[model samples]
Target: MRLAGNLLLAVLVLAALAIAATYWRAGQREAAARAAYPPLGQILDVGGVQVHAHVTGAGPDIVLIHGAGGSLRDFTFDLAARLSDRYRVIAFDRPGHGHTDAADTAGRRFDAPRQQAALLQAAARQLDIARPLVVGHSFGGSVALAWALEQPGDTAGVVLLAGATMPWPGTLNASYRINSSLLGGALVVPAITAWVPLPYARQVLAGIFAPQPMPESYPAEFGLPMALRRGLLRANARQVNGLRPHVVEMSGDYPGLEIPVELLHGDADEIVPLHVHSGPLSALLPDAVLTVLPGVGHMPHHAMPDHVTAAVDRVAERAGLR
Candidate 1:
């Protein structure tokens, strides 16, 4: 009996050490990535939160909101130069992502749509942008839609890229909930950052991208930046189980939207699943125009910029913004 007890004790000790070591590695990876891609200049304070935003171009205002686990740089770093010539494009690190304040204590709201609406109202007021056209990708799409609904008369239009407008199937998994937990957050997240390292995190993200190679800068842009990771994790926690309540609350509001709306979704998208979103959302909205791309994935905007850009042009023309 004594020998058996000793063996069990040893096994427990080993398991605990192994778990600690695993977290340590994750933390290391996160640190390295953060050091590699330091923040670029210019941040804006909207509603007491410091939001990192890049503004360029010279025509009507256009706000680009990136998806879950992304930064403002996701849209602006590579694509801004292209659109700057024709429009005043502004992309911001949404609250709890990128260089923006991780916690929006002032607002005390975690739902994507509410935060998005508040951000747009604050941004427009701060920047003096009048009824700017908005574009949101994936999670950002929900934000764009929410903002338009909240301020219907003030919006020129909106474009959604693989957005989660309608409630999608799938319950929140345990892992997602744990990662978002505040009690576990401080310990688990910091430990993961200190040990596992960015390369490994990049590999994990790669699995989600499917056929396309993960963007060369994904680690630096998403994984390595500890701040971005922290913000993303917090946002995820706040909306655990997929923000279903908010989605439900806002569902009936879609059909009443008065502004021009367009949705672009990939037929092959697995994350948000085209059936749950693009299919139903397109049908519900009073005047939504959806462009379904064959053989494409969730990140179609990033994967196929030219095609997405052309669609944006069409939306602009339809909205009479051109």
Candidate 2:
């Protein structure tokens, strides 16, 4: 009896240690991430959430939306530099990602489409972005699609980079979904992530950009501030949780898209799975043109920027901008 009691006590102690260790590590990592990526500019209040955004260049207006768990920097840093020369490039953090305020629920807060469309409309009004071409990556791609579908004739064009336009695959099980929330997003997750330095999470993100090395600035670009980490996680969780419903809601109307659309996808994409997403999305948009990169992964903009730029230019030409 004494041995059994001792064994139970040991397990409790070990569990306590594990939790403590996790908490400590999360704090350390969050600090590192924040220190690494300093905020670049002021925040803009849009639809109840304070969003981080940057704008540059001139001529036609273009908005770049980063994927789930990504920030405005993802697009603004490299791609924006190249595109901003001719087009006014605007990259804004979504409701939950980057510097955006995580003040609401996934479903009720800013549903992907509503938030995106409203944001574009608001940012356009605030920044004087007019009939801009919208470009989005991963989940951001879906928001772009949703916005286009919602407004019909309002948008000038859309560029979906490895977009998660269709319903998500079943492989994204419960645990993955939970971790996407608990480990990667929101206040609690970011708080934990801040200290933990989740290598697996980093690996998964890196894999999407496979055949390409992880960006040197990935941690800074993606890691949320400790204060905002949980908000990021919650927002990301809401994004995936409502993904299927959003896909279902938008699929029926995709065929009706009147704006010019271009889809750039890496044939080797593993994260959102190209065949499941881009395949059907290309078929759905009547005016959509598809470009497939053989060796690239999900982040085609980063992996194949030249090709991506050409595609964007093509869209611009079609829109009569170039």
Candidate 3:
């Protein structure tokens, strides 16, 4: 009896040590992440959440929303700076990404793109971004669609860069499924934030931008540490995992869309398939234009910034804003 009791005590002690270590490492990582990648934009108090908006240049307004696991830095690195010369470029760190806090503290209800769009719209109003041309990449594209749908009068045009629109086959990626769950988010997420290696993260990023080279300095310049922080990781996982069903519901509303849309997708994109998303979406919308990049992959904004800028210019022309 004493032997069994001692063995149980040892297990309990080890478990307690593991939990304590996880929390300690998580705290250290969070601090390091903040120090390494401090906010580059002004934080706006938009109702329940604080949004990070980076504004530059002075011309017609163009709001840029980045993909999952990305921040405003993704655009500011090159694209936003380039576009700024011709347009007033505003790049936003989406709710629960980068410096922005999640719209829902519970981290469940606000995973839908519509919820994110609403929060961004509110922030845009405060910033006086009127009838702006919105550009969204990957997951942000879905939010761009929702924004146009919810606030047509406020949106002049949309540019979707390999946007996830239609409901695709397959379950949520394994990492997202695990990290987004209650038990995993509470326990496993902190461990990942504490221990994931930079090389592995780079490898994953390379795959996403496969068939095209990622900019040499993108990982560091885009603030990788900020993306690996515990809270944002959980938020991204939840949003990505819960996205499919939301896309299904949102897809049905595409036919009624009136605003001009310009979609630029790569034929070789393995991340969000070109055939599944933009192809069908272009057909559904009345005023939609699709451009297929012959040899490009997912990150068109990086791989073909000229094409992306041209698309934005086309949308602006169509909207009579140019």
Candidate 2 lDDT, 209-316, residue by residue in tens: 787777877644555343235556666767667778778787888888877889998888877777888888888888889888897887888888898888888888
Q: After superposition, how far is residue 223 of candidate 2 from its true place, in Å?
A: 5.4
Candidate 2: worst-modelled 10 consecutive residues by lDDT: 182-191
TM-score of each: 0.85, 0.83, 0.97
Q: Which sections of candidate 1 miss by over 4 Å?
A: 1-35, 105-110, 221-223, 240-242
Tell me the TM-score of model 2: 0.83
* Better candidate number, 2 or 3, judged by lDDT: 3
Please give, for residues 1-322, the per-residue lDDT of candidate 3 as tens digits.
Answer: 9999999999999999998899899899889889998889899987657889999999999999999998999899999988888899999999789988886554444578999899888889898998999999999999999999898887999999999988998776798989988999888998888888989888887887788877889899888878888889888998998999989999999998898999999999988999999999999999999999988998999999999999999999999998
Candidate 3: Cα lDDT at 263: 96
- Error of model 2, residue 302, in angstroms: 1.4
The whole-model C-alpha lDDT of candidate 1 against the native structure comes to 0.73
For all candidates in order, the CA lDDT equals 0.73, 0.74, 0.90
